[model samples]
Target: MCDHHHLRSPAPVGIVDHVSSLSENFAELVETEDYADITFIVDGARFRSHKVILAARSEFFRALLYGGMKESQPGTTEIELQDTPSVAFSALLKYIYTGRMNLVEIQEENLLDILSLSHRFGFVELESSISDYLKAILNIRNVCHIYDLANIYSLTSLCNVCKDYMDRHAQEVLTCDSFLSLSQTSMRDLIARDSFCAPEIEIFRAVSNWAEHNKGQDPTPILEVVRLQLMGMHELLHVVRDTGLVSSDAILDAIRIQTESRDMDLKYRGYQVLEENIATTRLGASVIRGEMKTALLDGDTQNYDLDRGFTRHPIDDNSGHGIVIKLGKPYIINTVKLLLWDKDMRSYSYYIEVSMDDKDYERVIDHTGYLCRSWQKLHFPARVVRYVKVVGTHNTVNRVFHLVSFECFFTTRLFHLDRGLVVPTENVATDKNSALVIEGVSRTRNALINGNTHNYDWDSGYTCHQLGSGAICIQLAQPYVLSTMRLLLWDCDDRSYNFYIEVSTDQQKWVLVVDRRQESCKSWQTFAFDPLPVTFIRIVGTHNTANEVFHCVHFESPADTSVGSLINSVATVSVTSGPPNSPRPAQAQQGPAYPLITVDRGPSLSRSSSSSTSSRSESHQSVATATRVHFPQYYGPPPPPPSAQQQQQPLLPQPPPPQGLPSLHLGHYAGHMLQQQDVPEADRMDIH
Candidate 1:
């Protein structure tokens, strides 16, 4: 009896292995079609399936087979599906049994049909899998078609994915034939998005072209959504006026809004909300130049007036004469926002490259063949980069490349650009109230940092205090090396405010970093100062032109610990090591050591007092143990003499000119502004 009971049971199988085998068994059951109790005739093809399996897997099937539906009645096993394709129903049946479908094996057109059928059959898991697969294959050609399908099916996730892809590649997508072929509903949803970064005029052209292609289709509903108030007066008269798509009355109203000072819509500039721009002055971002530097990261992108931004000549040359942005430290960046000089209708062609070590660079975007204008929001494959260089290959206006503002970021969000600019949410002061201690006597302190830019008016969307009542103070969560600040003064009416800002590490002993008590300020105000350790900021309003109240809509300080270096307009830079026995400066030792690149920017772009002067630290006292370096100024060769034949030649069609090629004409009045500054020999010393 003892010998008969000694045999051991087989070793227990793992749960994963058991489940895999179970799935395989179920899959075999689907192929064998044993004990088939139901049949579906789809597009004239018969499919045998089981009633118990179908009822358990899908609610739609359960209702049709077991519920009070007619298909559940006696002798109703064979049901003909008029709308579904045989191939799509075949795939659906397999997925219902095995819980897996090979999307790669199905054609895209057939897969789209499967997606529709999955929605009808209530196969949510199968629908989601197909939607994700569509996003992976999205391109300029198929994005519009997919977007239309998403809209029709009310697939919110798929619609959002398609919309974001369209917005990121708006300029390219706008030109595709599929864009013109989109349904009116999809077209309305597209142009209505604020995140679409193309110029308002370009959107008008695209819509007008779409309307022309789809004749007999009433475009009144679609045309009503084109945000015509955002278009310029010049575009209204020159481009949109003759289109005949917009009614005469609508055109007049848009033109009137542009001229009226009371309309707030005129001030609404399109900005990307998808990602925060980390390439900022407060984050140690700078436009590195060989000689005289420019304030390309000052956070003031609206001003494209001469002397407001920077320009480089012979950008098409191989000498690497273009814009270089140092992002303070290594950042996982994939997007770059470039505000090209758009005061004119000129377009530019360019390429972008990034580097981690500043030596080995990788080219990411190359639009050197096509023309791009206004706001250029470029996205590339994500990579770790510390340096980004934008090289202009061609300019329709001239040979020189004019860039008003530059920004870079690691965009992870898929939201619309609802805010005033592309300032990162983390860097914005109002994102976390608990982390910041805000103190002030106002209508609502929350309104000041609510991140709402377009909904504000005289009575709402702002924090207000009677003049001289008390200063609005904010205590940061931690100390940061600060240098830049951005604020929006309530501009509902023709009112102005005179205010001053002070920063401090502790509650006591404040330092007046910005003083503007004498001059009037309105709209968006951005200022910068020498970097310092700061945790507290106080805004004191001295007077207001409108009654006795001071109002502020938004305030932000984009500060990071890695922001001690100089990023303002730089004229000269020298990085030298201190004597071996010399002690490092306390400020330098606290964080990363950054070379102070100081320049004489003449007038204060900070809008501070005229008496204020740029502060420069002595080179000897600020130097750390580093090699001394000098960036020499570059003056490009002169352009060739005018010729009738050269004037007729297209700029982009020809092969790139040789290195040291002369720059083309830079307009009549821009010659002096684009000239390279002459650095004195004494200031060009290199010490090691």
Candidate 2:
């Protein structure tokens, strides 16, 4: 209606406005629909929902698809979200809708939050994905925080990943505060994984520098954390020392902690270091020069080569310069004695040195002249030295100098302050009349004899008798606390026998703690007694009449006291008879009085009745009897007669069966025999 240009512009503007309005309406409708409904169909069967829906679903759904959810019960939801963040929901929905996530926008804090939710919901796939993301982003700056998050959620896998990443970049992370924080939070876990070595050195170095700068001020919280972490790495003791940051208190603390942990390697290293620093009372040296000669030596001399620049001299009469040995390690020589040559006596002077180098040598000990003879003995006080050089300055020259050996004994200034109990030396006697009689002996056989002779008897078919009439009185030099006793008994007749054990404080008094007469015993029965405090124990023969002998006796004490307690408590009672279930019954019982007793071999009996009518009639009767026999004495060969060769054999005796009972037999009879029996059937009851 107006100008032509104005009409054309208005038409175009109207078209653009209509298109814009339509596009807005379409987008709104798409947003309102379920995310699943909007699917991208790339192939006929391959369809993905819109990203919004994918991202909005909880991790539980991902876990189900990934095979992480084990149980899929109806009416049970694996995950439930309450007030989930808008961003998380949006991200989930976007993934569902588009099958892609904007990983760049996700921060570690948010990632961890989501990961926790995923783990809780059993979305194993999402949890793994988040873990991978964490690994990629882990750095010196953020590792400490990630470690904390892992610990808080009990995500051991994540924590391990973080530790590995930290260990790999230890040098770079040394100055990082986050690393320190991590060290403080989970030192034990890191130590358990052996992940702290590399980082620990770096941390020590950094802390040392910090300590120097701070001039003894309390270490920063970071340094303290580093120190705590180092405490767990006991093997890093030398590394800490090398860093020059280790304090006396710190070293001691480290030792205490390591000892409590019972880490053998750490404990060994600690001892090595401590020993190296402290002077020992025993002196030791290795030959460093010249050829060493020895007498009565039968091995290849080449195998005994000294350290570099040394050689062994062939066995000769004498007159060779002894190899000079230097002792750099401090030790105390307790005794000095040389191997006996058994040849003519040879005199030699030993030159000792205090310090020596290639350029200079200083003698701390004047030539201590000593005689080289058989059975020569010497003892000197402990000495401290940086070097101990021994040289045979003079000896019988070239006269077949039967040089057997040379040794200088010295004691250390310090010994292990705490000493363990010394094991009592076992002195076994083979004499039958001696206080102790050992039988059926092995290398480890030992026995403690109390004054009472009847207390213990060997059941292994061996006998031990005291040398004198007096009972073998085994007296402890001192009393000890006992915890346990073991006895090995042997049955010879292939029959089991029960025995009694008695304990006593005074040699004259006794108490019976075990009463096992009714139970069948074995050839080798181990009896353990409850721990008790006593000085004397006597094992007397209770059941066996056959000579009961003890093979080996072992006594163990919780604390060192008397050998008597240990030997009495721990012993072996070997029997000559077989184990239980042989030819012997367990116990003896009284039999019933009966006449016309009939014994049936099988388990049951049957009889037939007969009737007659003519001139006479007869009656039939049946009777049975079962009897068990008991033996009072063991039926076995007596111990061999004493002889020189027989004396060497230890006595292991077999215990005898219960005494005062004869073997019983069952019999059955009818008619004539029954009527003539002393006891009538009317007044007798059948017994077996």
Candidate 3:
């Protein structure tokens, strides 16, 4: 039929590229006076333009050119635009006609002017395009200026983009010359943002420099926006006290807030949500060669190279010497992560101090009373810091404190799983092997809380107890508002177990939070419930399909998988002091139950009938040969407790240093005592 139809088909319609030609025709009219019906005189430069074209392209111009305005009158031809730049007007006119702007041809400095015209003329598309272009081109050199212009123009989206850029580069932005040149209003706005990442001290320093640049400008208003309470006592007393920008009463109030209040938010500075490490050499950070004998900023947390870590010694606990890390610039930080020399079970006691200037330091952590091993994640009140000094007060194995790696950063991560100590019930007896005591506590280095799920086999990677005999428990360092938990049940084979979880503030009153006794479970399990202050958690297994023992490989609170798995034990802490008592079970609403989930079976490692005994013997020899750990032993009498009068007196002021050197005063920091509470003797161990 097609052959018979040999009729001529309509000529194929060719697609012509018409848009560019149309754009060119309009572009040609942009600078011409031909058919001109109106004239725009911007900054004394006259632009002969067509009224109909302007009316069609811009709502603002549509009203001004065709509406009942003086310029729209028949007798009116020339219209003067006030406060408008001629170059921007020309660029705007071209865009209006051609609908195209070659950003590569335009100077970055002039883009803001064009953007302003786009906003003023109600060119929504042009405004958006210009904003996007500006965002892509933003850099340390121009972001601050662009932010100011965006704020002035009330460009909400652009302003937020600029703010984000500034936050990520806060240290650089604060130190830039453009930052000092910003107007007082803009300066206050910039520093007041809760998302701003610089520390309070750095903010104060930058603003002070800004104030100096703009002489006669009162700094009180700008300084008021800084979170003074977030500053360490050293910065508060040495750096801010003399500024006179803030009143003495305000400074005292900030000191009171810092010392007496435990409001996490109040002590929190901006950048708490970022996960960037400011202590790495990649970020321009370095350990002071004179203070640290080796490099600890390399981020190598696994290697046991003796020459890779820093070491310091002390004749006694009061020695103030330690390794110091200097950031490339001042950064706001709240967390310090370091690897202890854990080739052995040896434990160490340490404290951390931070300083704006190296001369003045404020203690942020005081773990000298307890034992710590392997990975140590210490959190303190957020502060601006340039130097971090970690001083070891005691090392259970030797006179020297060895640290393998160190990292410092601001983290929005809410869970502090490392602070808890695993407390397996007496039924799950502690493996007496000294190798298992990587920290000061036995079984603290086991698989349950070590964060590793792949390295252990049937004989090791898991902690277990005979079903119905005893339970496994965890005692948090202190009561924390908890609502969720994540755990991995041993699942190298097609086996399932039944278990229940309970939480308690005191060992005498356990509240049932999770009851999986009726449901079979395997692999990773996440449990969530209403948040309550919890100090203890117990998991009791009721049944096991494959064997008489209940095995677990991992556990974490506020379930997060992004937390990097560590090659250590469950808890990194040990209880030197606590009470011993079993809590009677209490009735409570069961946490949300999870449905039974089938886990894919991996190749099973052969089980040993005497796995516990064999694991202990093997671990003992392996650990002893690789590392050494020990129980903490106090060589001297404990320090005297603060007197009631000493506790009542909140401030510890020191004399100002000579010259412009920083004052060594710590203000109320030293007097702000940690409220030591009694620890229950139930199951005391460390979390890995």
Candidate 4:
């Protein structure tokens, strides 16, 4: 009453006067509760007045306060409100000033003092903010309390978030006593949900290492955790196979958990699980039968004579060609085993025979022995034979050569070998030069023969021609050191002739390496020559009147020289380093040929003379003297005349004689040894 009129002097009649005037007018307009069409100015914009009024509600105010406070200072503690009674007022003020609620501050125990205020005052935003902030900070140590709170409040998202965080940092948080006390369901849920995210190998290693260290400790908890997380029995077995973590105690604990659980579905799964997890070991068994494909029955009960034993089954009578085993094909036979039942009375022999094209037969294995009273395993190296037949030669009076069991095993995993050389069956044709169409052999005319004459026609289609009492020769384009030679004749047998091999660095100089006459005229056989290096090779047929009608020719490196050189060189070097009494290493030491050297020296020097006079005289002397003294004489064998049967065939066109060219002989001639005339004048250089 004292000067109240002065305080309300026309509402101060300035900017405040206008504001007050507008407020009064708004109050009058809203007095009828008719807020139908009204406008109000807020922060720089005009809005419906009803909207502004609705925004002042407790819920909206709370949201505004929280948003504003978060924007102002992210990740900082929010301001605390007073008592529950003042919470609404605080929320209202925050909404009016910042349009958001700051209820995240309620995470503090002290802030919980006003939690009910937000719930009762219709501040839903503020309530939710409090729950979210709690979830972000909850951990294993406080998880129990948080869980109870979440359950009471029905906060499912918050509960899941807390569980997830605890599981991710389990090693760090599980040390807490409270975490260990979690209900089994809670622990199971946590592990099952998070296991997929765990590093599988690392977890396995850690669990294994932990169980190994704590051998005698109770493993129930660890086992329960793993059982809940393991997806299947196969997964468990894989883990065990790789990590070897599940100890006996751990396995028992897992079994107990499964038994106690009401999950009947896991029973069958568990049985298979344990069976697959058992450790496994491996053993191997094999059989051998030389080149034969037949299995051994029993040699223990009967005495057998291998050479005298022969079994014959005609191709027409052999109904089980499909069942018959093959050597070096479907299976390889290397060793044979025979089971013996009695020793004193049983003696037997075994024999194997193979036929070419089911016609002519050859024996591969022939052995005679008495059966001992023990199971015997025998080894046999593969020989060159095809069709195989096994027979028992002798039988005891009581036991009649009975066989218990038989099996054939192979060691050659890949590739199959035929009876003879494997060559294409078709595509054979004579060349324009009249050379015979040897199915798989290739030759060029650039090779040398007996003399400096390049008149050899490798492509000539001639089958067998009579040379005027001279040797039949063929040459190669490049010189090759051959150790073995095999020839297949078309109409004549290779074994009928006395054959000799001659090689020459220069066609004029020949060295005979093999001089042997055949006693039998077999269809095919290999002739091994002493290993030597030469440019030209000539085959001279000395005996038997049959013309040479070769259809196939093959050359191979010498086994003794080629393989021996490598092993011998190593042996020699080793022997040189040891004492002289050390058995001389059992082999000669050979090495690669000497390397060529280039120099600007003026004149050409003969290698023979220089090497003899050089510091390596001892080494050169042995090689040189051996070459000179051991040289074999070369006399071209008299050629065979055309047989009467060959003359009966119709005559064919004859090919022209092969052309001749100046032969170039470059043997052991080093580049540095050549004279200026040998090389072009433009390429010469002077020594310093």
Candidate 5:
């Protein structure tokens, strides 16, 4: 058994890739009609194919060709597809037999027809290809027609593209000849949206032009949704009514617009503004202020309108960079909502302001920069104001900004933005789900975001046995204002370790947010800094203060619970309720809470940058609770006695062990440190 071992490929060692050529051979058979068993007639063109192949590929073909009826019998084998085009049918048949589809020859008009035919026959791949092709070529002339088709087929992504295209080309779409063909509902919806690039008055003209196209039909109903007061009083009277299409009620609505538009009343307790026809899905997807709140509530973060992303210019820079909300009436607003763009490589530095009148703005949130796609719930002291403004002054990646949604509220409703946030890890052992942790940690992720502190057991917590400078990172799906991080350290090993903390909006460029690389503890750590928008957060281990292994029990954000109560002293050291020289040890002093004193790595992050030191009174304090956990060590038999041949062979140089770290031992929870008295050898389990 100890003699020798060898590895070899017992069977043929290499296999060539011939699947594509095999598919080509099957493709050729469609043209040759070799072993073909059925014929299909498409718009007078005849195509030959095998019955077994067609039955295998198409559900419709299988049912018609073998469903035990006259069509399944041997006598009549021809299938007539009167609706399919010859070119498309040929392509469809070839795909069924050879797993190949050639779309170069199909014309645009016929492609849509084939798209329908493919669905009728249950050819999934062909249908998807047709839809993708149509989506790519969408332009002003065909978007309206494509939009109608998209709705019919429930092709949501394609329909969204059509809507976005129309949003960017609103002016052209309004004047285009297709505008005359639109139904009243479609025109009304277009006019109601806040995303119109040409402003409110242009929509009035478009309505007038539409009425003229319809022999001067009533345009009053459609025009009522617009803010009539925004137009000059003379323009509303002279140009709008001159069309002879206005009604008495329409004139009344316009008269009310002047007073009603500026009335900031919060009579309604909860604004179900998202349901109003004024904001469509297309509006939710843009940078415009009107659609901002709708998108956030819709929970569709991935879809956004690039054309609507904008920032304000100080001196007529032409940027429409902010959103203004007139809260039906004023209430004391304590919370603001923002869901940043999804994994977008852009950062917007903006502010939140409130005012009784739109002109004299009082800053609610000063200069803040965000790069993550996470939802930010900004809380402030409740202040009464009718108007709210979100203004952007700077952008990191580009002048334009991408925002999935925006929201504001009078009540402070706690929102768990990272309920499903998946944290990414570097140089760590992952369990079955690619989540970082050693074995036995089953519910660590849930413990992190589930808002439960002091929630620990064998099934929850993270352990890393492997050695090196390991770090645990969470990549946010969106940028957010990361104000503080609350960590519940795992003290399973009486061992302690220190690690640096960092953050970044763009993953490639990093900023050192905290230097905790020298702190050691079994207690909770709260690293609170100024509010900064970050897409990535990392915990880089630099040293194991007393042992080799690392353990983390839970992680929580501010929204889950109120900031821990503030303590009198910044660094609070706790002594056990025991006599001096007692069995238990005293806990070290917890670090001081922040008005951060940061140490920058280099000029890469300038002192004046958004992550700069700032004064903020964040309310937080450490939770002091002792818990104990222990892990067993794996034991193996000693190595066999060195063989005569191994002893004779000269030793080779071994790889150098990792340097720059102190040596240590493991396995003792924070709650139960080792007793001062040594354990008896007999009681200790030693198998090595």
Candidate 6:
């Protein structure tokens, strides 16, 4: 009786969540727009909001609601916000009352508006929350669009996010659909960055293609951003002869510089690798067509196919029709180099079949569905064959297959397993090759693999939301024996993080290998894991000392033994940070330092002999490449491959074209992803 008494403890008031229930009720009432004290008229859509709640959530709202304005005294009020859109204010109201939002539910086209309006209304916290949401969803297709909005609004935090996205994905961003419409200023900013990862030719092709795509538009204006002087003589002459993309003046200047290579300041020797071309030799051989017209290759070398005026030539639209190039007595072809029309301007579908007898063909590379225009170096394992067949299948515009040049390059390495690997989500920092290290430069994606240790003051590292807990998954083209894993966190020799390394053969069942939870993180460290065969490795995060956010600049692993023991170099990016939470890890307990290496400049890939703890200038440059990456964890299987002879049709109905950019546009896309489906679902499996 004594135990049962005590008046039921006054009904335990703590059992009721006032704020939580209020939030839920507010959210439920959002759409009905019922009992709303204030109606915000945005782009003709009325958003009903409560005055007290709005004032409490935002200073701007407080000023308007109760700061003696006409809106504050209103009995029936409708605030006309023509400059803003409904998608934005709808989200803003929900967030103001509930302090939360589901970014996925918001249409991406409206994300910018939400962010802009957040800033405009002095919802500093909400604005930042929106920015973080954008950062977490960054991708090649949307990064440029997001940047445009971020730049227009001076969202400093978001600007950093865009720069980082471009740092690691410059090539893709430059060739992407959004890139064609990028303002000249945006394009110029990209070209000027030292973090631009691809060769000069990539830029040239993109610019030329953009000009062609928007035919009435003069692409020459964009040429001002092109640094033709950076191209080597061989590369320059080839571009001029093959593409006709460069002007006469630029070509002449490049020619003069190349002709005087002996006296020029540029040294052909000691040239750093830019991770562009694969490490394959262009086996100097002759190619002839089945019709025996020499297949447009008069000299069997680059730019020898036809004059620039020819533009493109398509193979006869018949199943057995193709361009056959005989490689002497069939040396194993490791790589096939195809210089197509600009990647954005045109896309071709083709089958790369190798035949011992020209009649019987075995498909070696079935690029039957992809639409690519830039230099495509396809890597397959060493296959000994006599005839290399380039068969056209389909194209985006149905134009004739435009072939500038097709060359077969051979190497001991057949597998280009890591070519187009992509991080599954924006939660992780995708890898990069080169990164800008200038002080005060915001963090860019280059930090992910820039071969540079992160500097807190410079923010030269990948950062995630303050409260987010996610994994960084690195998808591999083929399974490799795990060797060494390196992580160079932002800010050298300080800071701590709680994380673990995991592996998955099938992105479904993940295995935990390296567990370093609650351990003081290190700057420039390496850990050698026992050899394990795995297709993907995810670095799972627990926490970081910088309680504000979880960040890392570099995450790398050595290429499989097939790439051979490689060399590494190092660069530094500086950032200023308050004192980290705890004592730094003892130097003796830290892993070995990672020296950055820029691969694929030729077999003679070189690196700085010693790891420097010093800073590097704009002169410092490096690039890296990854292939065959994928994560099917929560995502559906990639689109199916096309049949050999089936006229390739659109995989999915082409989405209605994007609406033109909006002023105060929030590029926060929530619609379906505009992915290329580059790596098919079958190929993404363990190669073993």
Winning model by TM-score: 3
391-465, model 5: which lDDT tens digit per residue? 656566565444455556545344333322222211111121122211211223333333334333332334232
Q: For residues 409-524, could you state the per-residue lDDT of candidate 1 as single tens digits?
A: 76775422211112232453553532232554333445566656545543345554446665667655334456787777765433457889998755568899888787667555
User: What is the TM-score ranking, best to worst?
Assistant: 3, 1, 5, 6, 2, 4
Q: What Cα-based lDDT does every candidate model obtain?
A: 0.63, 0.38, 0.63, 0.35, 0.51, 0.53
**What are the clash counts of all predictions, listed in order?**
3, 99, 26, 30, 16, 27
Candidate 4 structure quality by residue, lDDT tens digits, 553-625: 2222222232221111100111122322232222322321122222121111112211111221111111211
For residues 347-408, write the lDDT of model 6, one tens digit per residue: 46667787655666667676553434445556665554567777776665774665555656
lDDT of 1 at 224: 85
Give the TM-score comparing model 5 with the true structure, all chains together.
0.43
List TM-score per model, in order.
0.44, 0.30, 0.53, 0.19, 0.43, 0.35
For model 4, the superposed segments whose C-alpha errors exceed 4 Å read: 1-107, 111-122, 135-144, 177-253, 256-688
lDDT of 6 at 116: 78
Q: Between candidates 1 and 6, which one is better according to lDDT?
A: 1
> Stretches of candidate 2 above 4 Å error?
1-118, 123-149, 156-439, 442-488, 491-547, 550-688
**Stretches of candidate 5 above 4 Å error?**
1-13, 34-39, 67-75, 102-105, 178-192, 201-247, 263-351, 354-688
Where is model 3 poorest over a 10-residue stretch in terms of lDDT?
A: 658-667
Of candidate 6, the 10-residue stretch with the lowest lDDT total is 660-669
Whichever of 5 and 6 has more TM-score, that candidate is: 5
What are the per-residue Cα lDDT tens digits for candidate 3 across 1-688?
Answer: 1232235354458954456667777877875567988888889899999999999888888889888887788878899999998988888889989898887788877888888888888888888888888889899999988899888888888898888888878899998888876777778888887668766788899888888899978887898888889888888888888877777788899989877864433634444336887777777777773335454766666665655555454526535757787888767887888777777546677788888667777888766655556665567656867788888877767777777788888876563433332222111112221113222122234546555555543434555554656567664443445677777776544346789988775556889988887776755566668876565577888876544556676666756534323212122111222111112113211321111221122111222322132332111111111122221111222235456685555222333221111111111112222121111233334433
lDDT of 1 at 501: 90
lDDT score at residue 567, model 1, on the 0-100 scale = 25
